[model samples]
Target chain A: MKLIYRHLGAIKIVALLAFMVFVCLPLVQMTLLAFVATLPHEELEVGQATLQNFSGILTDPNLRAAFGNSIAYVLINICITIPVALPAAYAFSRMSFVGDKSLFLAFIAFRITPPVVLTLPVFQLFSALGIVNSVFGIALAHCLFNLPISIWILQGFISAIPREMDETAFIDGYSRPRFIWSILIPQIRAGIAVAAFFCFMFSWVEVVFARILTTTNGKPISMAINALFGFQTDIGLVMAVTLASMAPGAVLLFAMRNHLSRGFRIGQV
Target chain B: MKTKDNSGWIFVLPAMAVLGLIGLIPLVTVVNYSFFEIFILSSRFWVGLEWYGELVGSARFWQSFARSSLFSMIILLIQIPLGIALALCIPRGRIWIGLSLVVVALPLLVPWNMIPTLWLSLLNPETGLLGRLGVVLGWPLDWKDSAVHTWVVIVMMDVWHWTSLVVILCYSALTTIPAAYYQAAAIDGATPWDVFRFIQLPRLQNVLLMAVLLRFMDSFMIYTEAFPINAGGPAEATLFLAVDLGEEIKAFNYGPSAARSVLYFLIIVTVAWLFTKAQGKLEEKAAP
Candidate 1:
């Protein structure tokens, strides 16, 4: 029985490793494709890898603008979302006001509404405001979805903190703002990190709004990548840009892996 | 436990304002536009529910709706079970735990637009590793001509992209389970299945419900990945609801598109409501 159990354990490990390889295969292919100076039609040869694709893509004006725009708008979206969500989430966790339940439900409803449904209306709305193809516009547009989710996740995180913490802080003569800044914030730093990571991820990866809301001026990396899909672009250059797009998210995930794992348990993300 | 503090309104006001300006206004505008015959954004004639009527009577709308529902169902069926199994199989050591978590999250971090492109390159028969392997295995991996192959690829891509979400959630829930329960089960000579069935599954109910809700919503809204893959090709076999809506918008058919949008929103809201109700009932039943 012991021997059989040990063998089963070995089998499980082998299966997991196989699964990991399967999951990573496409990514590995894309990375390799980015490096090699081979077209989709040409056969890949060993040791033919070159850095030209990377240099070629990085030097392209449109691709460079897209990279900058993507980073800018994602950061802007995170900035707009977190501060607003923090107070609202605090309220939901600690206090009850009129229509609070209904308001909360409405937020969830907004989160559920498909971005495609809002695409046309948002395009029209932004056009009227003369903010179409602007980074601020896309950032605001993203808040339509990101804010609710951030609030929801932060509310979960805040509620998990003991009520006594708040009570004790008040008794110790810490002003509300000071208490939030110094005491409450530090306690839920992991939650904030997770929430910020999610906001950044969603805004960075979202393509629908980015596609419709911006045309040329603030075209995001996703839109640029999609444009390449339309024309007969070189596969190597496309792969390089795609790989570059994954870098920010990869860095964020690695940096906050611990907070993310913890946040999953507490924030229900 | 409720605190009677209307002062909370002050806290919620900024978010509410932003949400109202950005979210609710557009939503209301979409509903309003559904009732008009819109030639353009600024030019419209009052049509009074004609678009909605047309949408309801349209065969394409029904087809896309059914397609979307089927896709979401398949995603849930595969990802949930596979996620649970993988979560169970994850090695319980410090380095293994950290490595697995990061590896699982890698796919989720890739931008939505790049996902289809990545898969396309990987499945390209001439150059892709999978394609070459398929050739060796004598399997027809053509996505262009075979609807079945297209569907298989879409499902495979989705499972690969999203199973990590389920794994993470379930793994976290598993971690919260006390070791005492497992020890008791072992002492009682319980089978591995018995230990899982009694202890882990019960503890997993809440997180699993959450996982189901999220996976359903995300999959239902899937467009960025599916569209770039085949653009609802192979005779429109993969033309899900969002892709269908996108076509209308692309053609600048604002009226019918708005109606479709409203209907799509309603379907999502209703299904989500039903899920929440079901979850509440389950919790009530589970509680002593």
Candidate 2:
């Protein structure tokens, strides 16, 4: 018991320091390089750094369109996923059906299925549906990946609440929908935020569907970066775009800062 | 704790329908494709499991599969412990907690495909800041030249990108431990290991299952960063199954790729099923 009691705090500090160095090095390097490389069409100087690449997000038509497309798809995916997942999670926790358990478990199975497997089939289906090459198509395509996990997380949070919350709400003459909205939703705000955060993150970072579905038009920022790498190999512009891609997620993580910490307070298993 | 109601299906109905269109139907299509020799969608001729048969017998398929399995195994072994350790080390002090969480979650926001681009810049020996630093430290990586070095960088990149998830989850599990429990441990003069083994580890079990499953499935299906990293270079030493599948898809080998997808998907689904079953057991144990 006394073996390491004296050095525990020091150990934690050392670990945190090591983690910070390891986690931040590549990112820091990227930030440094983003300044050094010149933007597209800019004549390279021997040692002069450039801020022109960061401004490319606003100035470049493809990048601007890609950013807009990426944001719209992410918002659409969350809107579709959260509303769908919430009700399913609510039912899984509060109500019992014949195959409810199996159905819930089935969601996880689909979630684990890789996006690569779904590419050709998704492209084929969307082309037939005529939603191909649109942000909406990419949004819907991401649902297959994000919905299951969102439901899983929401169900865990929902189940953690006491059953009495439901019983009392019902006895007080609230309808099932009303109870879920006013009382239940607020109570699980953190879960919803966590789920939404995940959905946003997944849709934002996903390249397979973004690449496959948006071949002709409506490319997301990831594809835009891919284009830059393929065509110009501009390190500065790529890092700038990559950093730009992270902006929404950073804002979201800050928004989720409190809720996320509290989100899993009930345990998400 | 719950009521028996068939109307619950009403709630599940929307997700079911959406997923049916997006998930189920595509899956069915893939399964259908696996049995055919596709020359464009319309020109596919029925081959009756020929692609799967070939995949099973082919040495190339098996070797890539074996290589991918080995990579997943190594990362899982490294990342799980590393994640748990980092999570434990995350101080709950008021000032640092929020910033730490935001920093930890930063990598998850980066597009998965660009991880390679980011790493490539960092590993460019002449130009990259990190690459230059490595040289200055007198330990330079032959990242593009050696298969072993490429593997190490890949592993390191994954650890950097993913360990935060485990830390966040473990933090949650730790948060669930009440102050009373800590006070009790303090009185008992329990060692750090004892607290971890008894109080913390028990709380972590549920989430660790989640973490392990997520890590396993992701590491198994890793494609985006890996494909772009070295493009399966250094004599094809890093041709993971997913990367190999990517090559097949890019080459327009539709039938074989679809078959490979089917085989690949089944492996994941089977593991997820087992995970679900195990989770059910854990829930049963935890119910009381």
Best-performing candidate as measured by lDDT:
1
**lDDT score, candidate 1, position B64:** 80
| Model 2 regions more than 4 Å off | A1-3, A39-44, A265-269, B138-141, B275-288
Report how far residue A32 has shifted in candidate 1, in Å: 1.5
For model 2, residues A82-109, the per-residue Cα lDDT tens digits are 9998999899878888898788767766
Tell me the lDDT of model 2 at A152.
75
Q: Per-residue CA lDDT of candidate 1, range A1-269, in tens? A: 65756586787788778779979999999998889876543464533787777887768888999999998998898899999999898888888888888888778778877889999888888999999999989999999878987887788688878899888999999976688789888888888888888898778888889988888689998888777764566777788888888888888888876666555554332
Clashing pairs in 1: none
Write candidate 1's Cα lDDT for B1-288 as tens digits.
758789888998999899898888999999998888987667889999888888889898888888889999999999999898888888988778878878987888787878898898888887898988888887685657888889999999999999998988888778877789989998999877777888888878867876887788889878889987887988899998888788889998988888988988888889988987897798798885
Against the hidden true structure, what lDDT does model 2 obtain? 0.83
DockQ of every candidate structure: 0.61, 0.71
RMSD (CA, angstroms), candidate 1: 2.8
In the order shown, the candidates' Cα RMSDs to the true structure are 2.8, 2.2
Question: lDDT score, residue A168, model 2?
Answer: 91
**Native-to-model Cα distance after best TM-score fit, residue A73 in candidate 2, in Å:** 0.5
lDDT scores of the candidates, listed in order: 0.84, 0.83
